[model samples]
Target: MMKSLITTLLLITGISMAQPNHLPTSIPQTMSFQAMITDTLGNPITDGMHNFRFRIERPNPVQGGQVHVIWEETKQVAVVDGVISTVLGSVTPIGAMPFSNNFSLSVALGNEVISVSPLTSVPFAFNASRAMSANNATHADTAHFTHQAGHAHHADS
Candidate 1:
């Protein structure tokens, strides 16, 4: 009998707040993914290397709503005492993913899929990034509007 493995997924993002006047030119698009592999008996399986497939999916239905796969990639990861740690987007850039949308993660080991789990709120950092960019643009637009209004008032005088 093939023992089924259980995996626990953890998602992490790095977010930093800059000063009002100092905005970062760019934000990192990578996220950290860690997993622990264990057997039914709750014992960690110390596997050397395994091909782990990860999928980020959102609900999309034809009539109502169905699950759709937005992004997927298989990577060879080293498991030490059943703990696997790797940075997502390192293999394939996930910058284009719709992080603002609700998504879930699916994990597969070899030909057998292990588990499908809901993603945490950590992905909101991507939306936060967009907000930061919008803040900068808003400031620029306000400045332009002020300058333009000043010129118009001067012309009226």
Candidate 2:
């Protein structure tokens, strides 16, 4: 019995140590994604009730092909004032960490012909940006970067 216990303890410790310090310790990380989709005229779009589908496309198949699109979440759209916002709150399953293809959020305006592109959000890494210069030089708002396992944001910054 003592021998078995020791073996189990050693195995567990080995597995734990093998995990990189930067990676998240938890399994399947579900995160919320939020975005505002507007029209070219800067008006909140009201195309019936829209639905926001959060998709984390798996990275590609190649050894390092951006991970499979492993994470996907869906939620209805909500309009506050004139701006429309889409939020999938904690819907993604834990362990769905796909390699980061474009972390994309798509808004279904219900019409493909008159589709609204301005309402679309780019990959997950991009945050809403504001221009600090008169020329409107755009820089992402860094306050919203998410912490993921095996990823280091502070060190990258």
Candidate 3:
């Protein structure tokens, strides 16, 4: 019984140690993703270069959304010990858009589309730009209302 217990403990420890680390919680302009590659037989694909295609999709209908690809790019990535890391917008430009709604990310290895992950947080840079625009508008409004000695303030009404 003691021997069996020791063996079980070692097996659990090994499995825990082999688990992959978590991906980044947030990304800015150049978005990145990390994933573990496994084969059909549940073995880790180690030391390989593969073509990966990434897509940002907008969901249609909102509730039960369909995939509408908004941005896409294909790049060759290196896989080491079943782990692959990639930047989504490095190859293709991530054009500016109003990120009012949540978007989903899809990764394709060669031709097979793997899975879609929901992007919960908006990129910090995009949010910053929006804030800057709001500040500019506020500044303009202040300038329009405040009349200087040499300047004439024209009221719309």
The best candidate by lDDT is 3
Cα TM-score per model: 0.60, 0.36, 0.56
Candidate 1 structure quality by residue, lDDT tens digits, 1-157? 2232222111111122222444445566667888898877989876799998988888886747768887788899999999999887788767666656888888887867778888876577668666544423323333433342322222222
Name the candidate that leads on TM-score. Answer: 1
Query: Which stretches of model 1 miss by more than 4 angstroms?
Result: 1-24, 63-66, 123-157
Off by over 4 Å in 3: 1-28, 62-65, 122-157
Q: What is candidate 3's lDDT per residue for 69-121, written digit by digit as tens? A: 88999999999998998877888977765677668888888899876888776
In angstroms, the error of model 1 at 129 is 6.1
By lDDT, the better pick of 2 and 3 is 3
Candidate 3's TM-score: 0.56
Of the two candidates 1 and 3, the one with more favorable lDDT, higher being better, is 3
lDDT of each: 0.69, 0.47, 0.74
Q: After superposition, how far is residue 114 of candidate 2 from its true place, in Å?
A: 12
For residues 1-157, could you state the per-residue lDDT of candidate 2 as single tens digits?
Answer: 9999999999999999998756444443544434455677877666555655555443355767554434455556665654454334455454633332344433344343222122244464353222211222223233233322223334323
Give candidate 1's whole-model lDDT: 0.69
Candidate 2 lDDT (Cα, 0 to 1): 0.47
